[model samples]
Target: MQNNKKVIVGISGGVDSSVCALMLKSAGFDVQGVFMKNWTNSAPNIECTTEKDFADAEAVCDQIGIPLHQANFSGDYWDRVFKKFLSDHNEGLTPNPDILCNKEIKFRAFLDYCLEIGADYIATGHYVRVDNSGSSARLLRGIDPTKDQSYFLHQVTGKDLAKSLFPLGELTKEQVRQIAKDNKLITAGKKDSVGICFIGKNKYNDFIANFLGKDPGAILDEEGNELGVHDGLMYFTLGQRQGIGLGGIKGKEQDSWYVAHKDTQSKALTVVQGRDHPLLFSDGCYVEDVQWVNENNQEELNCEVQIRYQSQPVKAQLKKLTNGYKIIFASPQLAVTPGQSAVIYQGDDCLGGSVIKDRISSDFYSWADNRGYNYQVYG
Candidate 1:
């Protein structure tokens, strides 16, 4: 059935991508493997991983009997994803670099390479599915909620969705592993990769220190009282509960500290004692730089909003803002961290998403009152 169809699969030495290639080969498609070289050189603490990844990809291709190609995308990765990551952190936002890497590098650069090579379609190991039956293709969540990567793929356009293929979408992680084991793929037993792809498994604080100099900041309590010291404000993210060395909270006892506020002006990190703290929860969020796949009905609409990758879907009212969109959640969500994504969904289909610029707390008015800031409450 897939005899004459030319398909290019992105093989990242990881099991997911390796299994994607194997599946395409089993489907009888004219499969070719392309290993994307995203980083020019591996950073500190992550040396030779990319090289190892390349070797694994090549091994998979050799075992699958397919021609393999490597494309260098370091320039684009630096200009597009890494630069934005730094900018967001400087502004006190918690940016998801993986999402940007997918949007800018994988789908854009890798797809362009596939097209240049005369491939009919480009496939990846993303857990999300694509439904092209309607007027336009729609990206849907993967069957495994735990492994669903649709949140990171909200930036994919309809056109991109139409030409893209996610072979592992219908299968669960276990199923993918089974397929690899059955086929005796080299990465069959490899552990799943975590954290940012380029940054690898190092401490985020250490990673950021390489690019941006370390600027230690005071860690404060909800009342702005200094409690401890953090390596840097950029190192910590909102909703983070651990790694904070507060003296009073001896050895993970007392109360868990959640990042509540950050002051870029004063370089201060404000934290709350407990997850149930009202100041850490938010009822609404402001998203900026919104992009949609299907531009047919670009008007504001009500849909489900996913603030973070594992967050349960929530009903939200969306209105187009001058720069982006204002999303009001049905209930207060805890730790609505800025610099993360606010992906919108309709049923199982991903609508679109944007970076979170600001958050509105349920007790915002009360918070302002306590802070003595004369802020008006707008409906």
Candidate 2:
């Protein structure tokens, strides 16, 4: 038992965090629950779930016989996370708001609060393991591969890793649910929250349209042929297969038209029909704005690369570029979309990662050769 160690656990009123607080408390640590209030204002007709979450957290704290504190971080969330998300989308890039929230709000502001309250450590329900040894700290993937969240946490620094604790890293989702059930926790049967935090269950397109004006654009097939019109170029992402309305080309032909490119200049969405071999694959990509948790200079490091959260880790050769780094995959990858993050890892340990700037492959530019097709063919 860790006797007399003061630990502050960030409780989101979810089963994972609630279990984390219970685990820490059972271990004899002086664990206090803190619910982070990050959103100040609410959107029209949208219910703010913060009150429910707070009440649930307070119930858990009472059940576990601990004190609960509330920290309001509305200003930081807007200025640091939400604003950057808007700017990144406006500039035609996919941004991960969760990463920014972890970097700026949760770790930075919450850690400050922990220090102010004379806590020795800050804990969360994140499904990532933290290891501190050999003169430094390391972050590793959780035991459950499906529920592992190390990809979104690559931005955490070594300093943050040292003082952080993850109680749910060794458990699977089922195990966490069982723990909550055994303890009769309020969030035992709660459905997992999806999409952006604070925004609740609102559709992504609807949320973006509130800040980013509706600038509809033409959806062009490969060879600059117009297939249909899209709601907005910014709303659609690379390699999107669904939601593009093309008449009569349903079943097989419509399935062929996967988004291959986005022309920001013309505000056009470019797609390729049929199983086009060349345009569907990429060797790897160039990633910029890299951050490393283990090493200061990521000049020489070999690690597995994860292009997206759901993507499997692939073997790659990493080389530091002027701004970031270039990753060459062992096998050809499909739809290495720009605006997504490319997180690198060594075994279970996450080294660092960067945002995807551009894709580099021999077959990526082959679609531009066919220029004879009419832009109004599908219109």
Candidate 3:
């Protein structure tokens, strides 16, 4: 069964990666395990888990009979991903750092390191499949749709994916755990990592505040009535229902409040009544930093778009603009926040994605020149 093909699997102290290494080794391919250290800092009173994660990764490699190599990419992560993330928040935008991490740290930095060390290919535990049948590799969603990670990986090019192997892509979370258990791996029951990689389970706003200091602002309604004050515009995102601190007001306490607008220029936090308020939805939006998996020449193509990671892909059209691309949803979409990504798909293939920049319109979003409405421009 020895193929003599050297593959480096990214072992992250998780059940998925542990099984990935086990399978690669079982298949007789020369396998090695790499533990990439991306984050080294922690918020106040929050325990640093990087040490334990590295130890766990090492243990899993030992169990799988592979040499575990540690590579510290903390500097690369901060410069390439974290700085831009902080900048996006300062501009009142909800940025996704994971996408940047995958593009900059995981695939670029770590992949390069793996190759320099004489690896034939780099593999990971990401729940995504690469179809290399075509001239250009096609990134397909993992069979288990619930665990598919193609959305976050939409920015990665087909070329990088072609050189990558996703062992967990063909297996469900249950099967992965079973394999780990059968092999007696240490990460058999490890909890999945959530939130930002550096922050762990710490309060998001609190952790962010440690980097971006406070900038007090006003909380207003659609009618320009001041309801409350905000610690900073960076603390909240559009459509966020919690942390607004308007739960126990005088008379309007019964009504639900959602973030409708964040104006960094005016230093304002606009809240709208009801979860499904008219001001929350948008018809379309312009996108920047578009990255396509395959070379797509068509300017206008009917496709599906996922505005956020968890949201279902909606019917949309990708229109190439003079300046950039735009996504026109078949129906009004809610909370298509700026700085978030909108991934395009054709059938099961994730074509590409881009960062949302501006919304075309929302029914009542255009008030006077703009302040509160169903339609407003993204920050």
TM-score of each: 0.94, 0.93, 0.96
lDDT of 2 by residue, 28-124 (tens): 9989989999987556656578888999999988988889999999898999999988888877787888888998988898898888879999999
Q: Tell me which residue pairs clash in candidate 2.
A: 226-375
Ranking by TM-score: 3, 1, 2
What ranges in model 1 sit over 4 Å off?
A: 42-45, 249-253, 296-298, 372-379
Best by lDDT: 3
Please provide the root mean square deviation of candidate 1 (C-alpha atoms, Å). Answer: 2.4
Single out the weakest 10-residue window by summed lDDT for candidate 2.
370-379
Off by over 4 Å in 2: 250-256, 274-277, 296-298, 369-379
State each model's CA lDDT, in order. 0.84, 0.82, 0.86
Clashing pairs in 3: 362-374, 362-375, 364-373, 364-374, 365-373, 365-374, 365-375
How are the candidates ranked when ordered by lDDT, highest leading? Answer: 3, 1, 2
Q: What is the lDDT of residue 91 in candidate 2?
A: 70
